[model samples]
Target: MKLLNVSAGKIQTVEIGGEKVRTAHVKMPRPEPWIITPDGAEGDERASHPDKLYAFARTGYGHWQAQLGVAPGEWNDGFFGENLTFDGLDETDIRVGDEFMLGEDVRLFVSGARTPCIKLAWRLNQPRDFLKTFAASRHTGVYLGVLDPGTVKPGDRLERVVHDPGMPSIADVCDYVAGVQAPVELMRRLLAFERLSPTLRILLGARLNAAEAAERAGRHHWTGWRDFRIGRIVEETPEIRSVSLSPLDEGPLCLPQPGQFVSVRMADPSGDMIQRVWSLSSYAAGMDSYRLSIRRQQGPGSNWIHRAQAGDTVQLKAPAGSFVLDPGSYHPVVLVAAGIGITPLMAMLEAHLARENAPAPVHLIYGARRPGDAAFLGELLALAAARDDFTLTQVYSQADAGDWPRSRITAGIVKESVRDTYIALDGRRIPVPWYESDIYLCGPGDFCDALRDELVELGGQPGHIFSERFEAAGMAPGEIEEAEVRFVRSGTAAHWSARSGETLLDLAERAGVAVSSDCRAGACLTCRTPVTGGKVTADLGDGSALLCIGRPATPIIELDC
Candidate 1:
């Protein structure tokens, strides 16, 4: 593989069928190019280092789905870009954190794997696929964040360093003989891989360990102190229980930022462990233990919780989610939640309360069917009463005799409740934040969508709206496929064709087009393209593409951007 032109930012245009085609936005910004200066002279266009170059990932596909008007499962393919495309040797053996020599001296490493988002589905039209790919092997492939800074051109040969196919590679080899029923040779092929390299030996050892555990337990389970089992279960309402879990082991429960969730794996009727996730209703108050004010869910896990007695061990994982409490420094944060979504918010309020040492002023609104339906009613009310800086209000829809009025959360209700506090929702916003407050919105899909709309009209900023939704979080094989593809930026025209098992970056460089991308796993949008012609698909949620990563759904296309 040789060096070629390296371009960064949102793909301006995609060339298809010899005409200019518009590509959708991949909710990420473009990357800046490396400008090198010899000695102390002015920086030049060539690469600054012989070992590395900077680039961006195609985050477009994921961004597309966030477009409210788009339908689910619309975005088909995925996006990501790279400085060099690879070929000659099979690539299934690549592991993250491993490096390689490309096109002479350009050193590349597998920094991480690709993980896309739903924004793509809402944007270009594939929300479910976006999530699936994120958790599946399709999210595989190495993401070389950056190894060294250097200028690269076309016709460079890629040299492997510490070449090894990690578990992901062996996993693929075994897939051929899995549930579908395949030839015994497929098993032989996997075994053969075991002999090719010592790395393969370690890989097999790891797989066998996982497989054995799966066999004995009838499933794979991750054992960790992530599950938080808190205090005595007291029934405060018809459907809610206030139980608390503390940091039994150490490290502060990791005391994750507010709005994070932990996956709890439990046993089924047959005694097989199944997994489910729940958000922490309360944040780390003092690290003594965190609380989970849970409403009874319909699943077996929840049933276990409902039936469990004191001292029952509840397996848990630490907090995990990007919906963290914003620093609340850049802008005031506006938090919106409905029903059970209040769990994480309480943590945030507690955090502020601790900092201020006094009741910090915060605007809080909650909705429930009735006063009886409200869980943690006493706790929330107590917090409000004690903290003069905090204001708490409830809107109930069910017919009930209570101090609060019965009403659903309508735009008028939300507007009326907030006298002048900053707002936050779960995800990106539409109308833009009038107060420009960082908005964090969480809950079910409908709540997110509805609140997103209402908040926009209220001047919610797009960048300020940060949503955390739960759907598919892991990936399965065949869910996302890697393809041989190429992207060319020749003059103003870009060309592409079936790669026949080559990396997109290598092919583009060969064709004399340059791409500036990073984490070429289709998560970041550093290598997005502006489709001018031809048809392209993506799992990331963008309409156009990240030529550095995505494989062509159709065989041929032209670009003029």
Candidate 2:
């Protein structure tokens, strides 16, 4: 590929799509004889960063002209915010770790595809849907890291110095980023490339691990209702126990993603099968069995599980849940847990630390009624001691003199934990902005809802804050008020009472109306159904109703279920 033009830009504010955006590379001009450094172009704003110090290269203007169906000169170099425009090499020809010789001395290593953000849509003055179309086109261009720094001018010849055949092409990376599912083998190959972006590698690695777990489970044909023998049970706290189980046939079991859960079915005294979903607390990698930390509740499910002994067999479904860590996100993580909610968060912590070149630091805030109620106190302390990037803060609502201060995990506590500056374990003050971190909340419904609402009130985006509750956490539907819900596709209607404490999906199931669902939480969109008529209230705001998490706001609701 021949370098047709080189460009750079300084930080400036520009108006795009009627919005003012401050960006350093708003309009990169073609600079002649650009000086290249190990960080990036000498005058470029994106230089000398560990993750994004590289330059971006896009195809020539002609390629965009044809793809966008625009007139000649309508779009030119730097329109897509690229630092370098090349004539010959397209995104399809570039692979992670492929090195290119620029001019006589400069070398650039292909890192990964540039992910399109809202800024690009604004820059193009296109509708929000254009972002989707742009990504689906697989022409987002590629990012290059400076391997051997030197100087280069316009018209410099670009030659391939090295190529790794095993690496996925830039197009493949784009496809993966766009939510296209890839085979396990392809994901593994992508993870093998060292020069690949850490974000993408971590993402691919997670996918590979999940796929391997599924493969192991599939080997034993373990699907639907299967018998799992209780392998071991250990008391975690005075009221909590960690139960380990393995397939009855002694076959390999699929490891669940951190924060995922499995449904366990046990026969009650009345000979009726009772099922309960519990979070898997243990890490998934290289695991032969599944482990769940259960708090002894008064419910029949928990009571039976606690009474079970080793060598006892119970029926269970394969592990599944949508409340999983986003492997693609590089932001720091804040895991908030209260009481037994620590189960899933512990799994997430383990998974994050086990990753190669772990992407971001983790801050864990856990609270319980007392020190004796903390389930994984020893394990969490050990993990905090081992990893410098991990910070643990414990809160006890009812603590003795020797225990932690009697402080409940409230909005105030959360705010303090995410402050801009905090004293580190080594006594050094560090600046860590909590708003930039992804916060995961798992605990009692009321506790989680209160914290989630508080975070949003504190300017936290709903999308960045993930939550999972063991039971319904919202306000109780006072006094029985019957509401009629009509399913358009199924031609079935059902009457639901606000006091029933049932979601739209629950009402549908009771009325024998079929609706697709997974996760049962609002995280997965599988249960999202359009509301053709009437109105419904939901914790999520995606225009459509998440049946699993939605309740009728109006007396008569129409669903396209």
Candidate 3:
């Protein structure tokens, strides 16, 4: 099929349904060859939907003209706002897994059908029912995902290099979007495709039912507390130790996604139960055991953990966190961490390297106080030595004569490392642009916030960066006016300092009242407690407070502890 036109649009104010709105829906054909990247057309401006990058097939312009009785001149090559308008290949003809070479070097894969939105109706000056009509017909064009990045121009022929007949066609997806019922097996097979757009995946999953879909997405793992025996412990550094855990029942634990953490419950020196969280550092694609890399701190809970033996048992809930890697991403991965924050990023690096077909490069920029304090230094160096795709940059704040650069990790170090990074693709070294790569930042709050601001100033995409900061340290006791706190369920009344910044969970422990908590941060909702009589600093949408981090905002408060 020959490429008819190439289009790109910018954000502009336009009239939509008698109201002015800012949108990039109207695209004008460009004369020069357009650069195609993983993010889509080089100059195209997109809205909230990032998944639908490029669109194909304006061959249905004739069909639209006949159906809507519109003038022939009204439909141009890019009237549908598609990036690359082509002929001959339409929704019905393209399968989800179909791969094609656009022009010479550009490779495009069929991801899904273009799901019409209100913007489409607005652009065409038609009623909202136009979206329904567009979806009902097979005239809906197929959306293309960039596989091999290159340049595309008008008059370039679209050559189909690969096609799998077993996969569902783009038309089938459009039909499903229009609320047509399909066989369960067909829907399952559609959902199985890795390249399918996430939006369409959710839609199909809803049609198939939520439970089965959640299971497919690895969200139905076991929850709540279970007994785990410490399998082994290794001292990674002078202050950081790695503890391996296995199910006491000898059953397999569900393999955790890289970058997840498990919450542990154990007794402190005072014989009182305390909960804490640590990031998992080891991942091997199996579920036989899990490992946590804990940094020794001044807290009693941490001291107890460091003193525990291998045979000891701790109550642990299933691994949970949103700061995990994107398995489907085809972009370069850059991991930045400091001190104990290296724990989760370590898991992410190892997991990415273990992939059978890791297409992109992975770079890690880590910092520590000194060589003695860096966790897994030997392992990181060994990986860098063993793999050509891996790059490591270590900066020590308290570096000696042996350490290179001998300075603290700064935004310049990160930006320069990524700026010079390259990925080996098809025997060619392609520079990994900071704007396109997926960057993960984990460290103290101030560290993350400062680096993020600097990176944004230096032309980094804020959305492409993901960060998880260390939990805020507990407040220290100080002199302040005492406030009355009442535990409604336990019938216990205690005095708490309003200015002390202590959480309700801490007050409960001091008052000899029992409360369940995990993470000791606002993350896990295990410490959810209802605020019965007064205001709290933290509130979940259900009017309950996260007792682990929630404090009394008022002079006096009551909690259902």
lDDT of 2 by residue, 1-561 (tens): 677666666776665433344565465665566787886766767311233333444444555567668787776676777777776566677788888898999888887876555567666676545665776666777777787889888879888889977777888788877767788777876667676765465556656655664564445435578898897899999899999988877777666667888777889989997767788898856777888899999889889888989988888777777888765555578899999989999899888777655545788889988878999898888988988878888888888423246888876677666554221311233233465468999887788888999887775656779988766323223233778899988988998887787989899899898887654555445678888877777634445777877888778889987
At residue 392, what lDDT does model 1 achieve?
Answer: 73
lDDT of 3: 0.76
Best by TM-score: 2
Model 2 Cα RMSD, 1 decimal: 7.5
Query: Residue-pair clashes per candidate, as listed?
Result: 131, 0, 0
State candidate 3's TM-score. 0.62
Q: lDDT of all predictions, in order shown?
A: 0.47, 0.72, 0.76
Q: Kindly list the per-residue Cα lDDT of model 3 for residues 422-530, writing each as its tens digit.
A: 4343335544355557899999978988989987777576777898887654333323356688999999988888566577889999999999765776664667888
| Root-mean-square deviation per candidate | 23.0, 7.5, 10.7
lDDT of 1: 0.47
Candidate 1 residue spans exceeding 4 A from truth = 1-231, 247-252, 328-331, 357-360, 400-405, 422-436, 470-561
Clashing pairs in 3: none
